[model samples]
Target: MKTTNAYLSKTVNELKPSGIRRFFDLASGMEGVISLGVGEPDFVTPWTVREAAILSLEQGYTSYTANAGLLELRQEIAAYMAREFQVAYQPDSEIIVTVGASQAIDIAFRSILDPGDEVIVVEPCFVSYSPLVSLAGGTPVHVQAETEQEFKISPKKLESAITSKTKAIMICSPNNPTGTMLNKEELQKIAEIAERYDLLVISDEIYAELVYDEVYTSMAAINGMKERTILISGFSKGFAMTGWRLGFVCAPKEITAAMLKVHQYGIMCAPIMAQYAGLEAMRNGQDEVEEMRKSYRRRRNYMVSSLNELGLSCHSPGGAFYVFPSIQTTGLTSDQFAEQLLMEEKVAVVPGSVFGESGEGYIRCSYATSIEQLQEAIKRIRRFLEKQTS
Candidate 1:
């Protein structure tokens, strides 16, 4: 009998289970659990996008294409970036279609990191970066963002995180769990720091379409930064095609080539059906994407206001679907707050500690849920907090 690899690779063994999963599992089994835990959009893939996938299957376009992905899809991706984000990429040489933004992150970390290289990751962040960096034989350096700054990282904070072993800085905007973004001036300052440190920037722009304030700024669009930045984005959030597992990364030709080598061997290619769907979404589904963005913006505004009214200090997120609110008023730890809320009020929100140690005093509530669900969740949360105070 195999002894379960008693000497399992340390990196694999060291991986901490995601905190988001535990709440989801509990909410899944419990009756009447209103979950604000997941970060995915609540919308279905638009009919036009779905129909494109079906048409591809009917046309027998099911076989795997080039490892870098279908040329048509890549061209469409390039066009979309140019049209929407003002970023440019040569479809043939500077982009690799991956399984999702998740896979793009994995491929990037593996490609750039040798053992012990350091990557600066801002918290509270999406949960995968730290573990993925470790899996790639790199150390993740976490820099905590303060609530007064709306959880946005400052250039001074970033400068302090860098050292001789630092290889890259990971940027997510509209950031996960926080829904915060780095403005143009902020991006320029970060670009200056990255230029000085000779750091690679792996920017996760998966939520680019969900911005409610001003236009989303692509780090790649900043001069002197484009060549050093690897942009990762996908149809999952913007087009509600999460299940399709389609994502891509755009980078300098040399970096893109290296990433494609890994994709060729490990991933082979993204799902053919999904690539077809993504192409269609980029081409003709603009109106649908806009509609979903409007809805999420409305929900975000409502949720943040409600949480603030309860005397919880919640910042208005400029983008993304989450609202990170301080739960300090209840004097409960993030985990304790989430647990009591779920058990007593039948409402589920993620504990901030799941993102990193800096997330301790807050909870991340996603507004991807429906308006009706959002209203009910706020009611439950209000009751739960009142009971705690009483």
Candidate 2:
């Protein structure tokens, strides 16, 4: 006589909701709350990109695209990859246009992972990673990239985590929540380990263009990595096109073929208008992209300096728009800090523990909002901290 969701797939039922969204939901009904938890860009999509989608709709170009997406969009993605990241992928056989980079990651795991296979999920990563791997019939092995090492996983730690069940390693450069970018040399070391273990590398490069001080390097660009790497990128973070739901996956031809099967069955194709917008974004959106990057860079500087000034030891992130600042000095756990800050100060931020266990002592504050919102959020947080000390 127990109430139950017995009809639900065990995986779906057992999976907890996104930790990022729990707090976002908590703040949704509150008035005057400055929510700095979401990682979305506050900038509007560039005019040219938005206009292209509008023009396409006006012209009645709303029919479904190829299962892999519009060929022209795919070609542009290939060209952009070659030009920006020095990675070459054949548009025809090696690319699948997806609903978002999130979908791309989902399909990539579905295509290659078998039941009981394992993927080493580098921490502290995006919230969706482990759940996606689970849904795809794979086990997610969490591996911490220590804060002392600037949130980068060392080769020794990575190798130690590998097991006979290990089939792949998933890494995000310019990582979400932390904003730590893995450079070319660091990536080369990971590539060598991947080569040694014969494990595939799923590189999420969605934030590749938002980097501030360091150069972004694609895992596939590393020597001998092109074949073993599945690169996922999209227009969401960098191009400010989140609502458009357009992203692409680049992999070896065999892998792409398998992923296309999953994608075609699950999603069929990305939206036609969104594809047009992405086409325009890659072709002529660099200047606007840079403008947004500069804004984020300026905001990042302010947040890092301000957080440090407030005694929340924060590492300077090389890229991306979020800052993970340690709140350990206050003797409060991350969850307590985020919750109390929200309740008292009406400023909403995500507790870092939601990202992964290694994120226990920190909280992630996104600098993607306006400078004004950020400044106000900081002030509110300052008042909250003073109360804690008092």
Candidate 3:
């Protein structure tokens, strides 16, 4: 009989597993390992959100909701989007609650891409974007954004990457791996490119609530862009509800209909109880979000300053909870720095190279952990650096 590995689909066999998880697994049981890896918020889900879920269970709302999710939850999402970002999406036909922002991205790609269609992906970004596009039978074309550029893709570079095969552009503001956020002016440049090329734009704003220095802008709010943008966000980072697996997509009606077809066949709907929790979050979680954002901002300031003082150059991130610090000064490749740091001082960080080719000389350090943990980790890292130079 053929082996299971042999029987696996070629696409499945070819897909690269997440590099973040590999390091996380390595550091899992090591004593004194202070992980600056993993981008999850360390905070628990707010009591009110959890209480809402418990109440939902008590009310016996365990059944599957409509394939598009509960109408009420969708309405809350619509209202939340309007209030927070000033972007209006029709609850009835333009929104679909998803298992997570991850799934929303998957379905968005499936809805829009055909085999060989090219999706322009900016780096250093979240690890999943390229793989997800590939899984959807689309080719991912990468555009490297350097630290000098604040890691924002330049419009000239973006325009240069376009081709007859290019069908969409995927972006993450308050980007993962690096916490750099694109401003309104930056987004307007990208909007012009998308409009000129008639390309779909998938904007993942999962960390929208975590921005520290400036107001977050929704691509959908850009003139002439809403009709072509598939806006993906969720309760995970903002509401500390990662385990709830609740996210949503706001797109034009036709695109939403296509995404819903894939969602119905695959996920059916987001977990019903999670939907209830998300409803609570959308309606009542802004204070909790702001509190978490403030905590992250303080951590970001400390981490960035500490890294630079230690001879590792790092930029001050305006959003998200990560700082991408250049490790080139240490005369070590990113993987070597991460591996040695973990083995020596037990301070775990993700190598920037894992995010993309452009990330080779840097490392991603997440500030999502508590200030106390972050302080300890910083001390450990400093000790390790001292040993290296000594």
Pitting candidate 2 against candidate 3, the one with the higher lDDT is 2
Residue 92 in model 3: shift from native, Å? 0.6
lDDT of 3 at 73: 92
| Residue 72, candidate 1: C-alpha displacement in angstroms | 0.7
| Candidate 1 structure quality by residue, lDDT tens digits, 121-206 | 98889999999999999999998876688987878888999999999999898898898988888889889999998999999999
Residue range 222-299, candidate 3, lDDT tens digits: 989999999999989989999889899999999999999999999999999999999998888889998998888999
Candidate 2 residue 329 C-alpha distance from true site, Å? 1.1
Name the TM-score of candidate 1.
Answer: 0.98
**Ordering by lDDT:** 2, 3, 1
- How would you encode candidate 2's per-residue C-alpha lDDT over 40-107 as one tens digit per residue? 99989999999999999999998999999999999999999999999889999999899999999999
Cα-based lDDT at residue 39, candidate 2: 87
In model 2, which range of ten residues has the least summed lDDT? Answer: 1-10
Instruction: Give the runs in model 3 whose Cα sits over 4 Å from its true position.
Output: none
Each candidate: RMSD: 1.0, 1.1, 0.9
